[model samples]
Target: MTPSKRLLSLDAFRGLTVAAMILVNNPGSWARIYPPLKHAEWHGCTPTDLVFPFFLFIVGVAIVYALETKKIDISNHNQLLIKAAKRGAILFGLGLFLALFPKFNFETVRIMGVLQRIGIVYFICAAIFIKTTPRTQFICMTGILILYWILMTLVPVPGFGAPNLEKETNLAAWVDRLVLTENHTWKSAKTWDPEGVLSTLPAVATGLFGMLIGSILKGKEKPAAEKTTWLFSFGIIAWILGMFWGLFFPINKSLWTSSYVLYCGGLASMMLALFYWIIDVQGHNRWCRIFVAYGVNAITVFFLSAIISKVMGMIKVNANGEEVSSRTWLYDTFFTSWLPSDIASLAWALAFVLFFLLLLWPMYKKNLIIKV
Candidate 1:
């Protein structure tokens, strides 16, 4: 596909990922979540764990489509970098805003999060794409993954001797504590943030993985069938490699391990390829309308949803002589009252996804994409 022509498959893939994110994030009760929706406790992979990485992978693919033209001209490089930096800053600021909302607690607020990581990975990957060849990008990605593995496994933690991948004492956790301090780390686990400093290295590799796939899809000379074949081939190879790597490194989302990067990116690649084949090549996209709507204005919906969810929690209602969050009251009244706890939670989450789809459908019909 050319730079001017939009990729419906990519948009659909992104939309699906974002929809999953909203579903997993906004259950009626966190306590009553299904296993698939919940992130792996420490070392393993789950459907929920795939969501963030898939989005990051999409970010990488998006960078190629967005900047391929500018990349061809060296003169446009500086201007492109400036624009990327500005966009990254906006993303990071938005994440920070979410963290500070309602409470506005600077001292205790978590610094690193999903959007912050996306912003950081996007800028770095964009810079790499701008300056380097695809071959070089692949090499860089490989080197970073290997280096992270070494650092996490070989280099001993300062206070907590002998490098390990435990919850709070690992090298990544140590870096989180030292740099961000316990105060700025994840609220639930003040000792470490899942989106902590060290783990971001592999996260960038995940983006680079998507960039590679994006290059394959963007190739002018390759036939659509050939491109799909390559996507499937590369995806399978990466997935198998990730599984092998996991034997040693273990696939851990909290740490964003190199293994997890490959595993998630590989699945994301195969998924995008399937979408590309069905939607872009065969012109069978009738069922993808809802995803397209979500995909087009993804960041806008995500930011708005998060803000609204936070507001819902902040607003209180009197419930039988007890003050409770509006979200809790609504859940109790509309969902849990009638259905089983787990099913009710899932129902609420599904409703939340559909609600956003309803909001986005009109905007999509009018072609009103709110770029963030």
Candidate 2:
């Protein structure tokens, strides 16, 4: 693939993930959501839980594509690192701004979030990619995963005594509560943030997994068939290993467990392989333009959609002689009134996805790809 051109599959895959992310996040009524849309309460994998890590994996792939190792030399190293840092900072800042928005509550604002974790993982992975060989990158990725396993399993929580992977008493949750404090943690669970301090270690590993695959995909001499084969093989191996490992660690997305990394990363790898085979290797391009639009301006749509959702909730409109949130009013009037409860909820979420895609279409047509 040329530096100027992108693999259609990657964009389609990313756009699909982003679209799913929006759908899961914005159901008209949370109570009526499909089982697949809701995250597993604890210690299990759900389709909803896969979106974030998949995006991180895609990020890793994008890094390899963007900063082709063959092109960068030692002299350009500092500049590349700086650019990576700047991008990471912008993403981090956007997350922070979201947390502090509307209320501007510095005291009780959730400090760690999805985008913040993404930024941290991207920065660290990008730096590692630039400085290290594939061998070193592999070692680093494995080391982080093993180290996280050891920390979460062997290291005792401070006051709790033995190591545990419970919702609040686990080592990672303990660290989040201790450092980020109850006030600044996830609002839904004040005692522990899902995207907390120690959990992020393994999240970095997820990105590295992507970077490794990205490197493989970027290999110039390798045949497409060979690359696709290797990806499928490794993906299956990782998926099996993760399942076996889950007996001990449990596949917990909230914790970003090592096993979770392998499991989700494996699925991501296989999905990418399928996409690459169908889109790039097969030269099928006619049907991927919608996803390409979403892919090019992913962060832009994600951030804006989130902001818009919040704003909609804040704006009240009179409905049945009582003031209700605009979101609520719209949902009740059009969605629930026309469709079944669950279907209406899903329709509302799908509408949000379409709304954002509409916003992105013109930009994609103009090639106004916003990179952050």
Candidate 3:
């Protein structure tokens, strides 16, 4: 693939992932969510868990395409790194803004979040892509996963005694408490965070997994069929390995375990391979326009969607003599008044996805992609 040419498959995959993120995030009622939409309480993976890793994987693939030209000119390396740092900072700042919105409580705001993790992973992975060869990147990715597995399973926690993968007393949780403190950690847990310090190491591995695949996709020597075959094979092998490793470490998204990295990365690789074949290779992309819109201006929609959702919750509306959130009032009036609770919740989320699609379609047609 040429550096200048856009990858429709990638944009479609990204759009699909972002759309899934919006859908899972914006249910009319969290309590009435479908089982598949809910994240696993502690261990195991769900469809919802796949969304974040897939986005990071897409980020890694994008870094390859985005920085291809800059990577060649040695003189441009510093400038490239600076630009990446600024973008990462902006993403992290946006995440912080989301956490601090409405209330703006610095004292109690959660420091790390979905976007914060994305920012950190993207910068580190981009640096790795720039400074290291593909072989070295693979080694770094593998080493991080192995080191995390060892640390989380073998090393003992300071005050917690034994090494553990339990929610509160795990090594990652202990590190989060020590560095971010309970105040800055995830509010729901208070003692630990899913996007904590140590777990991010494996998360970086997930990005590297995508970077490796991106390297393959960008290679000129290989035919499209060969690339698809290799990706599918690698994905299946990695998937099996992840499941086997899970027997010991247990695949957990909350900690982003090494096994989980392999599991999700494997699935992401296969999914991208499929998209590349059907959309990019076969030239059957007409069906992907909706997702393409979401893909091109992904960050813009995500940040805006989150802000709008927060505002929806903040705004109060009188509903039958009771003051409820606008979101609740809308859900009650439009969805739950007729449909079953779980189905109504899902319908609301689907409507949210289409709502953004409607907003993005015109922008996509006009080629007005927001860079951020």
Candidate 4:
């Protein structure tokens, strides 16, 4: 693929994920979202569950493309190790900074997050890939996915004994208690974290899968058309297999089950092939420009929005001398108030996405990509 071709497809994929993220993350009323937009309760998949994993997958693809056979010479392996260590630390440090923002508390803080998972996986997987073959990398990915599944499903929890999907008894919660000091798990699950250790194992697989794509893209002599066809064909096969496995393992984001990994990986690949076809192959550039803009500086926009939304929620209106959060009032007045129902609020959230995309368009055009 040409540089433009690469940029277009990644931009579109990243843009779509980032936009959906904003929508799901900022709904006016969580109660009102369409079923597809909401996450599965315990052990299932939803359209919403695909976004974070999709981002992780993309990160893996990028790492392979950027780090493979580069002049970053592995002649002095120690130097390469140092570089990997620094990158991992920096990524984790950034995640900590975001977790500490607005308030820094040792207690009741989130220790594991999306960025943290990415950081750890990048370091571990990159270290292995840097010293190993593509075949070994594939084997490692498969082993880790299956290993995590066995550990979570078969290994008995201390005291609690065997693992169950129940919030209180799951391996996730058990490990969080052992590893995360109390109150440091995601606030949504005071005793558990979706970004916990066992889950991260499969997430590494997610990234490894992307590395496979990146390697294929970096192939020396295959025709682009043949590559595209195989990608699409492979996606179909994986989707079918994943669904069948889901019947036994059950696709769940919180657990980051192997089946979930297969399902999301397939979905991500299909979306990529679609975007590559429509944007790169078909030369349809109009709508892609908007997505590319948001996708380019995705992390910045996400963190910025998180902080801004919190700040806005803190703004209070002294209505009749009674304090109330103005954020809700503003969103309702601007988006939810006039709308007939929940769909209107959803539309308003989407408009909010495009508005930010327009804001970010110039930065993307100028080749300004932000990374943590």
What's the lDDT for all of these models?
A: 0.91, 0.90, 0.91, 0.77
Off by over 4 Å in 3: 1-4
Candidates 1 and 2, the one with greater lDDT: 1
Model 2 scores what on Cα lDDT? 0.90
TM-score for each predicted model, relative to the true structure: 0.98, 0.97, 0.98, 0.92
Residues 137-212 of candidate 3 have per-residue lDDT tens digits of 9999999989999999899999979999998999999999999999999988999999988898999999999999
In the range 161-190, model 4's lDDT, one tens digit per residue, is: 767667768876788878885578888777
Candidate 4 wrong stretches, greater than 4 Å: 1-6, 76-80, 319-321
Measured with C-alpha atoms, the lDDT of residue 222 in candidate 1 is 98
- What is the C-alpha lDDT profile of model 1 across 237-356, one tens digit per residue? 899999999999999999999899889988999999999999999999999999999999899989988998999998999999999999999889999999998999999999888988
TM-score of 3: 0.98
What shift in Å separates residue 172 of candidate 1 from its native position after superposition? 0.3
56-149 in candidate 2: lDDT tens per residue? 9999888888887543688888898898898888898999999988999898999899889889998999899989888899999999999999
Off by over 4 Å in 2: 1-4, 69-71
